[model samples]
Target: MNSITVLGSGWLGFPLAQLLSKEFSIKLSTTSSSKFENLKDENIIPFIVDINNLNGDIDKFLSSDILIINIPSKNIDGFKELIKHILNSNIKKIVFISSISVLKDETTPLLEIENLFKKTNLEITILRFAGLIGYGRNPAKFFPNGKVVKDADTPVNMIHRDDCINIIQKVVKQDIFNETFNCVAPSHPTKKEFYTYCAKVSGLPVPTFDSSKNESNKKTVKSDLLVSKLNYTFIHEDLMKIVF
Candidate 1:
């Protein structure tokens, strides 16, 4: 069986590792030791890894056939150090979990970190995800209580957590690497329409947005490349159908 090491087994990482465990040997990492037994219960090899002050045996983590990096950090300098360390590893295939926020703003700090990998020869697959919603995360919480959220007419670009895992699984199985793909739902709903509905369902104060705002310059992120290239179907294509 192919061995896969998942760095940063948190929200998305934990479920992802669980799903992939049936098909591949799983190695999961956490910053806290408290989560070790939980990971172990799932039949996953658990390790304590702190990228900020990495003191663990990195060689053992990179010993797998592939590495899926799900850690989130804004410290560019610290990421540069991690990049340098990873470049020295024997691991060749890497699946980097990034966000689509980099698309709207190229100056996003994560983009700077991602660029460092572009300089390397490793097979890198960068997944730029949209606003992640599912499970513990609810978009209603972001709108706050009766606060005016700008871009009311601007279409919301969001992706479900299930889709995120499915895309990664497809990427690994198909051997697709060295590319950046926007991972989001195809349908785009205006913020006012989407959030108002979300607030009602969650019993939160509905957010207000200017109805007169012009949406001519608004850009809806296109996430068709992955579906087109990999022929993978999104489980939650319509955000309205999602149950919180």
Candidate 2:
């Protein structure tokens, strides 16, 4: 079985490792020692890694056929050091989890980090996900009660956690490398419509929207390339119908 190492064991990474462990030898890293026992209980090899300090035996952590980088850190210097270690390791493929926020803002460190990986000799696939929802991350709870939410008419760009995992799995299994794909759901519902429905379903107070603002230059991210290239169907294609 091919070995795969996950750099971060958070909301998306931990569950992804669990699913991938069935077919591949999975090694996962966490900054907290509290999660070590839990990871080992699930038959995942656990490593304590802190990229900010470049701590832990990263060389051993990278001793795998594939590496999935799911951390949220944007420390360029830390990645520079990590890239040096990656260049020296046996990792053949990499899947870097990026955010769609990079597309709207050029000042984000994520864009520069993406460029850094692209410059490398190793095979890399970058997945730029939209606003992550599903499970405990409900969009309805984003704002407090009676808060005026802007962009009521603007369409929302979101992807479920399940779809994100599935997309990563497909990319790795299909050997799609040296490419970047925007991972988002097929539907683009207005923020007002979607969030109101979410609040009702969750039994939360519905948020108020600013009626004065115009819907000009609305941003809606699509996963057209990801869908066509992977030929994959999303588990939660319709965000309005998503529950938990």
Judged by lDDT, which candidate is best?
Answer: 2
Candidate closest to the true structure, highest TM-score: 2
Residue 3, model 2: lDDT of 92
lDDT of each: 0.85, 0.90
* Each model's Cα RMSD: 1.8, 1.4
Which digits, one per residue and each the tens of the lDDT, describe model 2 over residues 82-174? 999999999878999999998889999999999999999989999999999987999999988588888788899999998999999999899
Off by over 4 Å in 2: 40-42, 214-217
lDDT by residue (8-127, candidate 1, tens digit) is 888899999999998998888888888865444455888888778776576677678788999987777766776676777767888999998887678888898788878888899999
